[model samples]
Target: MSTSLYDADYEALRALLKILRVNAKLTQVQLASAMRVGQSYVSKIERGESFVDVLLFAKWCEACGISPGVALDGLRDQKRPGRAR
Candidate 1:
């Protein structure tokens, strides 16, 4: 499938990720520090300006104290109404 910032499901995933980070009580700066990158990296990812590959995603989940499997399930359950799968 084609991935883009405009894709509904992809956008939902990004939003969910941001929500997850917030729920974990980590600001972008904190999360970025945990991930050993600049805050701009986190901001860019949240803004969908960067594509998060699986390895990075797993690291991100780890930094947030989240299980990647659980996150994947959440991602799987994300489906916007009227959007083609």
Candidate 2:
């Protein structure tokens, strides 16, 4: 079994988060405030220096007015092109 994310997975995760922020019409600072974290934390996540586990993921989704299920589905559905099913 794999122990890490594929490059496409990471890119997809980053894109999902960015899209969420944009859809919420939030600046990084604004999202940080709502998530009760520092702006750098949000930046780090966006830059893929950090990742959210399930609990934090849920919290982030809540803060962004998204459902955690949708985020999880996005993460799972970002299968790399040409990857065997």
Candidate 3:
């Protein structure tokens, strides 16, 4: 299948989610519970098989005790190819 413009954004978002979760020392189950979502939903997101709604992304940031803008900034950084590590 062909990728869409949002593909990059989605991948970056997923990466940021994984990084934030690891940095916070939270498991998928814990994060899922915090977000009031299924653990599988978190897994799918981490695997880049799902697209997250902006409101849901905000909820995730809140659950992680972070500002949504901070998470968004990380995603933005990842979207830049050479900037990713």
Candidate 4:
């Protein structure tokens, strides 16, 4: 297992979160407001510069109008090109 933020799974999480945000019609700034953080924070997470913890992930899901459970349901099958940590 790896702890790198740029890993494929993490990248998938970022992709999913960005999709959910767009689907929810929320901008990065809007999601940041809902998540109680600055826009750059959300951008960092989505760009894989920041490693998001479980609580933060849950908050992000809720901010995008979905439950953490729903987000996880679609996570496992997320595939992406491999990259070095």
Name the top lDDT candidate: 4
In terms of TM-score, the best-performing candidate is: 4
When 3 and 4 are scored with lDDT, the better candidate is 4
Q: What C-alpha root-mean-square deviation, in Å, does candidate 3 show against the real structure?
A: 3.1
Ranked candidates (lDDT, high to low): 4, 1, 3, 2
Model 1 residue runs over 4 Å out of place are 80-85
Model 1: per-residue Cα lDDT over 1-85, one tens digit each: 6777768777877887898899999999999999898999899989989888888888889988999999988777556456565
Q: Sort the predicted structures by TM-score, highest score first.
A: 4, 1, 3, 2
For all predictions, the C-alpha RMSD in Å is 3.3, 3.6, 3.1, 4.5
lDDT of 1 at 1: 67
lDDT of 4 by residue, 1-85 (tens): 5667877677888888899999999999999999899999999988888988999999999988899998987776354236332
Candidate 3: which stretches are off by over 4 Å? 1-6, 79-84
Clashing pairs in 1: none
Which lDDT values do the candidates have, in the order given?
A: 0.85, 0.78, 0.82, 0.86
Estimate TM-scores for all models.
Answer: 0.85, 0.76, 0.80, 0.86
lDDT tens per residue, model 2, 1-85: 5434446666677778888888988999998898888999888888877866677677778888999899777667667566553
Each model's total of backbone clashes:
0, 0, 0, 0
Clashes of 2: 0
Clashes of 3: 0
Candidate 3 lDDT, tens digit per residue, 1-85?
8655257656767778788888888999999999999999999888877777889889888888899998787667766778846
